[model samples]
Target: MTTVTTPDAIVTAARGWIGTPYLHQASHRGIGADCLGLLRGIWRELYGAEPEPVPPYSRDWSEPSGDERLWAAAARHLLPGGAEAPGQVLLFRMRSGGVAKHLGVQGAVGRKPTFIHAYSGHGVVESPLSAPWRRRIVARFTFPEV
Candidate 1:
């Protein structure tokens, strides 16, 4: 038996992982996860298997390679959408001209906007979508409904 996954379900599953310790290249619910790990964990909960095998990556996962690896992978797997919906995946560039490496799942939208991410030193936490964060958004995507 498999669970029916919806946008709301994705948000709920991601929220359930709040407080997990941030760990590079790891993804286990309530254990450890990075920004990408958090998303991968939610994906596992929504679907029985990972869409593709993730290669072991360094803390700087392809930034030196000058490729938008995270953004590319999101485009390949998730549905493209505007960043105005709960459960949408958000890709961010840490700095101008940098690769879009950070990721988060949108939480509350419109009023009291927030997003869930496993930030370094912060672990998994839902952060307010402040103007600074909003400005860094490079791409948005939603999990494909099952």
Candidate 2:
């Protein structure tokens, strides 16, 4: 499988998005990007297109249905992470029992880990992979095949 696993390239691409406003259901490279849009933007940078057409999803992924659809979809397409390196996708569960809905790109690892993400109120910002955030991580994934 062709993969663009370069950490610098991924980090650089994500860094370019700093200050982009958060707009849900939108994925423009610089204009507006939500958390998923940030990842989708990087995917386009490395692979030219999103791996699959993201179906229209609510911020709540059908809470009444109680489905882990986003996680399941990530499992289907993106490369899963366990022994992960920099540039991998980090999926986070915002609350203890909430769905795994946040997406961040692993910017660095080892002592002082960091990740880049476009938060709802916080635009595109790079935050430390602090204990609180780390505790919320439900899954980690890497770029898809190029």
Q: Which is the leading candidate under TM-score?
A: 1
Candidate 1: deviation at residue 122, Å? 0.8
- 1-146 in candidate 1: lDDT tens per residue? 12766668888998999999998888997789999999888888888799999999888878888987888899999999863888899999989988888999999988689999999998999999999999999988988878
Whole-model lDDT per candidate = 0.89, 0.82
Error of 1 at 68 (Å): 1.1
Cα lDDT tens digits, model 2, 1-146, are 11464777888888888889888978886689999899888877777767799878888765668677878878887877767578888998887777788889988889999999998887898999999999999898876545
Name the top lDDT candidate.
1
- Estimate the TM-score for candidate 1: 0.95
Q: What is the lDDT of residue 11 in candidate 1?
A: 85
